[model samples]
Target chain A: MWEQIRSNQTRTLVLVVAMGLLLLLVGYFLGEAIFGSGIGGLVVAILIWVVMNLFAYFQGDSMILAISRARKISPDDHPRLYNVVEEMKIASGLPKIPDIYIIDDPSPNAFAVGRDPSRASVAITSGLLERLNRDELQGVMAHEISHIKNRDVLLMTFCSVLLGTIVILAWFGSRMMLFGGARGGRRSSGGGGGYATLIIVAVAILLMILAPIAAQLIYYAISRKREYLADASGALYTRYPEGLASALEKIAGSTQELKTANQAFAPMYIINPFRSKGRAASDLTSTHPPISERVRILRSMAGGASLAAYEKAYQEVRGSGRGVIPPSALVGETPVAARKAEAVPAEPGKVERARETSDLLWKYSNYGLVNCECGTKLRVPPKLRGSSIRCPHCGRVNPLSSRP
Target chain B: MDCPACKGVVVVVEYQRIELDYCTKCYGVWFDAGELSLLAERLDLRGAALDVNQIAALPEKKAAEKARGCPICRKKMKKVTLGSAPEVLVDVCTRGDGLWFDGGEVGQVLGQLKDKGAAADEQGRVIDFLGEVFHVRG
Candidate 1:
């Protein structure tokens, strides 16, 4: 595990440096081609890189969180969810519990963000809490915790920084060439400049066309590998492979899309929250492994959850030699205790708990809840004044009055 | 605000820009002043047009059981009967904080509204008559 973390940091550093240089080179070419001055574009490119790097290091998590409109929730606000996060923190032997957050969206999705575990925050949508039973919920939390423990969040942040910069630079370069903005340089440099402009145009086309694909290919490789490792580690942490498998099925099966999930932040989620039917295992552009493939691998794990089991299953499903769990991770790895569906928390009435999960988000946001005898939980406003209430579930009328 | 029925905390969520408070334990929903109307408006359900006006006009109800304190102001709330088919009665805070409904009540209210909308729509009424005549699928 230690070796894996070290390698992860090393790879992230290498990738960032490599991508940064690529960005500067593209900038220099485009600057000379468009502005008649390579130095000006280089300066602008460097400044952009530095600013993005600073943002990714210091405030990337906050920015991502704000974009998603995530609200921080205290333990007392949601004991069930808080407990799951606490359990994972202890299991991972982390220094402290990661901050927990809730998104008001109805989609069943979750993601973790931060530079490290101690500073990390995990957010889950309201739909998730209402849908999964305890074990499944625990499974989801464990996967997120594994990402934090494995430093994948930091890797993803770096990925965002590099990919984001390159895309922006490419877009700018392409726009300039297509829209006649490069004429400034073409006209100023005179006769010899025509040949230079031709070269510039060709280079811009190449960079605009191939640079992002190259960056994305790199991003996809790192992302998919990290996902497998995280899944293995998450199963190991929870000692329950089936839980995550089933949870993934439920998440994937749902038609509800995550309303606020950003493309830049998609790689950080447990599964891509966007609408993508193509299997990530097959698609070069996907940031996640296919849902069916992942679930199949988890279900195939014999005995207890372990890296060795996952590797074996990975080979069996995707064929041998392609799985990415580090050899260091497999060393001294032991099978975790297998959990059955019986271990699921006792919630017999959850099937009837429609939209109650969103209701819970409201409760956390300072609304009131009413429990009906028919197992229907209602989300209520704080300032409500009304008469007789009919239960939507059973049609039973419950009395409401100011005085008892 | 604390849940009036249960002691659990409640959180606010926005649906179509209307903020509604919902309890984690009970799954009940609450709407604040004018929020119900706003939600109904957003839902575009026809029956809801009659709800708010009818609710304010209905006679005060005799308490059926122990009256609960308002979750927000801790005062006694007013019991207003929702007057219409698939009728609903909800407790509203006298101080105007909001109204509370047990789980699934929102669906019933919305159902009533939709039913009314369906009834009034010419195409819907025609479809219903034809589907019923042919014993069509649910």
Candidate 2:
């Protein structure tokens, strides 16, 4: 695990440097095209990159939570979720347990975000809670915690911020070239350096069009690999590949769409948010690998839950290519046997699970509950706190106080 | 969520995990995109009686009432007619956020659905539950 983390950090540095170089190059060309010099554009690019890095380093997690409309919850809000996260925390040997958040959307998905393991947080949708059972929930939580433990969260944060900067700079440059190029063109036409200026402007336009696409491709490539690594680590932590495999199957089978997910935030989710029916074509542009392939890899791990086991399964499933887990991390690794499933009480029915999930969301939304004597539970919103509500089932009038 | 019709604050009333937001002032009910289906499922009415997507995809109706904003997205909702005889006009969010039924419209719409046959018994249960909850009769 330590070796994986170190390698991840090194890769993160290389990614940042590569993206930074791309940004600077784009900036220089755009500056020269627009202002007849590359210095101004390069400075602006550096400034944007630095400012974004600082912002992301300090407030990235909060920003992600805010965008997803996730609310923080203590153990009392959902004991099952908390317990699973705690179990994974201990299993992964993390310094601090990541704060858990719940998004109200009905889509089944989850993601992790933070600067490092100690500062990390995991967010799960209400739909995910409503659908997944104990073992499956543990599987999902373990995957997210693995993301934190392996330092992928930090690397992803920096990469996303850099990607955002590149996209913005490219967009701005293209718009400037379209709307403000006349002045530059006229000036160049009047000078002896007309041909040189025209060539520079043409090159700048081409770069602007290609830069964002290039950055996105790089981001997607890195993100997809990290997902597989996290899955491997998660299985190792839980010592149960079936748990995650089943969870992935459930998530992929769900038809409900996550309302909060957009193109920019799609990569952060466990499954690609904008999923389509055409599997092969979508795989190239998707942030995560195809769900079927991931499930196949997990289900094929015949040995056990060790990194070596996962690597072997991965190679076998992918037809003998280089495996996902780093070679150094698997050196001298003994096969870790998959644990038996934990004994749980009679599993809750679908309706029961839905009720639990909705009850939690209602509580978070500050809906006051009033139980009627006839067995109907009425949830009154805060707006109706001072008013009385009648039971829908039994027609009993329930009085409400201004404050609970 | 604010009532699309009355622009007044709406209170959520939940029973068996099916939540509905209704305005206290206008007594208008708001059924979020999937809540109606949830209610139908609770009542075991499994057919096409409450397919929200189908209802949302219904052609727009030209109504005299002014367009109202959706409580979820705050975008102007379109007027659509649901069911046949005495066609009930309801406000459906263009973005599929929810449907807004004015004062007695919920009962009217369900009453029409019940009259449409086949699932009348199950539909009656939903109507009865809503009537008792909101103190209205279909």
For model 2, residues A113-222, the per-residue Cα lDDT tens digits are: 88887888999998888889989999999999988888888878778888898899889888887887634587787888888888888888888988888888878878
Interface RMSD, per-candidate values to 1 decimal: 14.4, 4.0
State candidate 2's DockQ.
0.32
Error of 2 at A272 (Å): 2.5
Model 2 residue runs over 4 Å out of place are: A1-18, A180-187, A276-282, A341-343, A385-387, B26-28, B32-51, B54-70, B73-102, B109-138
DockQ of each: 0.03, 0.32
- For each candidate in the order shown, give its overall lDDT on alpha carbons: 0.70, 0.79
lDDT of 2 at B112: 53
- Tens-digit lDDT track for model 2 on B24-99? 6777888776566667776777876566556667898997888888787787888887644546678887766677
At residue A238, give the lDDT of candidate 2.
92
Compare the candidates by DockQ and give the number of the best one: 2
